[model samples]
Target chain A: MQRPLDVLGSSTDKRIIIKTKSGDSIFGILKAFDSHINIWLDEASIDGEKEVKLGKVLIRGDSIVYISPEK
Target chain B: MQRPLDVLGSSTDKRIIIKTKSGDSIFGILKAFDSHINIWLDEASIDGEKEVKLGKVLIRGDSIVYISPEK
Candidate 1:
């Protein structure tokens, strides 16, 4: 079985949703991440629909709830 | 052998640490929970030291990172 990080890494360039404790999620192309799980997203949206104008965004690892790949 | 919820239920009255998405944790006596995994803790503390006067507290399931039994 692939490790969790490996699975997360596989989602790179794929549209994924990064859920946070706030009950909200960021949907974007997974760009980069580190051991801490902090992420960088390109052309991200809030909840996969509401587009955020920001070209790229950085999310703190500690604030992460979970990361799910969009089908 | 016990399931996750069962194991959590067994931790009732025992001091446990409920880690959250923020990388912070709630330490307290596990008192109650539901199928959703939302939890209630008694005499809870933040990070197991700084006491929060609140006697009981509720934690949203989605915000949970993990729970650990404290020795």
Candidate 2:
């Protein structure tokens, strides 16, 4: 059976859109991740409202709703 | 590390709400699941609309946006 990691390739350069369990929508570039699904994103944004100046942040998998490749 | 199945527990009678990646919101009774996170739900509904007579269905994990205990 294919794993979630397999569903998503290991490239840290793909752009993705994420919706958090708390209902915050985000957009960013995938940076890194672990087995627990914890992820780091560069140039992230929330609800398309403002740019997250840090350009990098880690997201806990438990808070993840869905991750989609940016089209 | 806590797994998704562990996070949800083994109770099949609990009520749950799920938001799919396609954006349909469903309310139902959690029935069963596997490692892939495929889920069975009884009495499921879409967007809080009409009741689903089949009362049972499976949801693939990849399409899941979020799952929450009925609140």
Candidate 3:
């Protein structure tokens, strides 16, 4: 069995797509999760410059629009 | 055992407060979480009104601002 913390911690090197209520989408890799459920998102870019750290965001489970596996 | 999906699903009746990267705060009950990680937030109010559905939002782990337990 897996836990919510495990799911939050399991997003390493995995390409995740997040859709916002404002109708926005963000694609990146899950870096870390804290007690607040704050997420560290590393955006995917083609420039290969570096991981664009999206900082931290408070996300309620119900506010989630969709989550899917990346190609 | 717990999973991320479980975490996403476990927010029922929980008073969750979300902080956005834009320096915005939203408080509500977690209604649901879909495959896209989109969360449906039910905002809290004192007017005795119904829950304000915030629809869905995409939140990267890193973009999290903060989340704390309500008093």
Candidate lDDT values, in order: 0.68, 0.64, 0.47
DockQ, Cα level, model 3: 0.07
Best by TM-score: 2
Clashes of each: 0, 0, 40
Taking all chains together, the TM-score of candidate 3 against the true structure is 0.34
RMSD of each: 12.0, 9.8, 11.8
> Which candidate number maximizes lDDT?
1
Which runs of model 3 end up more than 4 angstroms from their true locations? A1-71, B45-71
Q: What does candidate 3's lDDT look like per residue over A1-49, in tens digits?
A: 8775675455566876666544445566765545544344444321113
Q: On a 0 to 100 scale, what is the lDDT of residue B36 in model 3?
A: 49
Better of 1 and 2 by TM-score: 2
**C-alpha lDDT (0 to 100) for residue A24 of candidate 2:** 71
Identify the runs in model 2 with alpha carbons over 4 angstroms from their true place: A48-54, B1-71
The predicted structure with the larger DockQ, 1 or 3, is: 3
Q: For each candidate, give its TM-score against the true structure.
A: 0.49, 0.50, 0.34
* Model 2 agreement with the true structure over A3-71: per-residue lDDT tens digits: 335423533687766656665767789887765567789988777455455478898876764555554
Candidate 1 lDDT (Cα, whole model)?
A: 0.68
